[model samples]
Target: MPSAPSERPLFLDPNLNIIFSVTLLAVLGVSSIAPVFPTVARELGVSPEAVGLLITVFTMPGILLTPFFGILADRFGRKKVLVPALLLFSLAGSSCSLARDFEVLLLLRFLQGVGAASLGSLNATLIGDLFTGRRRTEAMGYNASVLSIGTAVYPSLGGALAALGWYVPFALPIVGLAVAFAVLFRLDSVEVEPGNGLGRYLRDALAGMKNRKVIGLYLVSVMTFIVLYGAYTTFIPLHLSERFGSTAFAIGLIMSVGSLSTAITASGLRYLARHTTSERLITYAFALYGVSFAAIPMLPGHWLVALPVALFGVAQGMNYPVVMSLLAGLAPTEHRAIFMSANGMVLRVGQTLGPLIMAAVFAWGGMARVFHVAAGICIAMFLSLPLLIGRK
Candidate 1:
């Protein structure tokens, strides 16, 4: 049971507030600036592709560093890794405002990605530590709900601030610093067993992932984000502007529709899980994604664009927490941090690949084709789900 509170807001007893709030704010480093890339390109006298690297550079390092961060969390304790990572995230994120050159900004973004790495893998580790069974399912739902809300809130906040100036959005990271301070004071360190040497850790990681069910979950992690981030970090804003003459605010608001829908879906996942298995939930979610992306280009107007985007959000909301919760079940507690961190690394790989691959597709056949290709990939994955998941 989560500890009961005596005086502080009740969630403080379990650090749920700290977990939810910090994880929510932790992601602004990515979500806040995505909509502002066009304006940043203009201000920096760089191509939109160069500006897109702001997203990519920040995310790319998460792929490489997540395992190291995972090992650190397991060895040093989650809070020990978390506190300093939060500080780096705060500093690097805020430092983006000071960057006069695109290269320098990319450097800062890469460093920020490294910091961002811990919040994800470790938070999942912490969740696995704190809750179990239905409670863990419920907690993962709340975690997804917070993520969905952040996805909804940050882009709009960044867009509004970006309208003031490209530099203005950079100030938002200071708020993350405040959240970091809260976490520093509030979150307790989880005690962990002594870690085996790297060879053993690697052996254990391979052993767990060798399970076909776990392998499928990791593959789902890669493919799902490829479609979603491919859309989110790159073309959708530009497409909206071309079709609707959208300002940053309009783009952010339209984007928020999908995330808001995700929030609603995630908050209700406990109930959803009651009726279905995670495997089926994930398959259905991907099908929804395939259909939604295929439909995005067919949108006749700004409002109609949201119809497909909302469906994508539902897919993500239903899919992500279930996948993570399922992964927690599959992994041993002793090595959970590293296992989940590997999951985090694959997520970064997908996030980076999504935009780069979609860019190539957009170049060849434009936005419609991008969605078409994304649709095809999702459908292919959906069709192969049974084989990929195999026997548990």
Candidate 2:
């Protein structure tokens, strides 16, 4: 049985506060920079499609490196891996503010991605290590809410920063240096028993990932990022800029609207999970995704676009925490880091593919066609969920 809500005040724990802080940094990886993409493209003299590569190159490293980091965390300790990663992420991410050339910026972003490779997975791993049962679920919801809060604040903040100078927002990640030290000094180290040998550990971890349910959840995670990165993060800002002549501040506010909605929805996930199954909530989230994407292309004005953006936020809030909670539950205690890291690996695949795939579509057609196609893909994924995850 799980502890009562009254007995456990979720955010009051120092360990969870560290987890929340790390989660916020993890979010800053993408959200803080997304609002600045248009400004970067304009200042750098890149095409809209070319600018999308900012997202692509930044996400590409995580696909291959995340699992490797996970294994290291499993064998060694979380802080050993996490602290250095945070420092690297902070330094590389902050240096982007100084890059005058586009290629140099891409290189800096790629390095930042390397630092970010393990953050998403490690945060979840820490949550699993520190909490159990309903407390874990509650923590996941609160953590998701914190992630949403970063997403909400970063864009508007980044946008506002961009209005001052295109490079100002890039300097924000320098705060990670402080966070890195906090993790190094303050976060409790999670010790893992070095079970058997590396070969056996690999075999055991891979075995845990082979289940059909795990595979299904992984697919859902991949699809979720595809839509998130492809439409919301990559193209939506461009659409607003090109079609509406919206300022960077306006773009940030628009993106922040979706994130604020996500924060609100995720904050209530504990109650929602009590009333509905994860699969059902996820399915409903996909329906909202489809509707949101379809409505985006039809919006009469950028201000009115918040309706669809808010809907998309609800879908995101519904999807991420549920999928993660389920994955955390399925993960074997001994191999939890690798299992979650594997999910992170696939998440990077989705993030990498989202921009490239949507950029291709944008090149082939236009913004409206890109979103229409995304809506179709969301509906298709929704229909396939029964086959993927099955009726429960």
lDDT of 1: 0.81
How close to the true structure is residue 208 of candidate 2, measured as C-alpha lDDT? 84
**Worst ten-residue run, lDDT, model 1?**
1-10
TM-score of 2: 0.97
Candidate 1 residue 271 C-alpha distance from true site, Å: 1.5
Q: Write the per-residue lDDT of candidate 1 for residues 142-243, one digit (tens) a residue.
A: 888889899899889989988688878886766667767877787765677666787787787788778988888899999987887786557788788767
Model 2 spans with C-alpha error above 4 angstroms: 1-8
Clashing pairs in 1: none
lDDT of 2 by residue, 162-219 (tens): 8788988888889999889889888875577677999999998888899998999999
Residues forming the 10-long window of minimal summed lDDT in candidate 2 = 1-10
How accurate locally, in lDDT, is each candidate?
A: 0.81, 0.90
Top-lDDT candidate index = 2
The C-alpha RMSD of each candidate to the native structure, in angstroms, is 2.4, 1.7
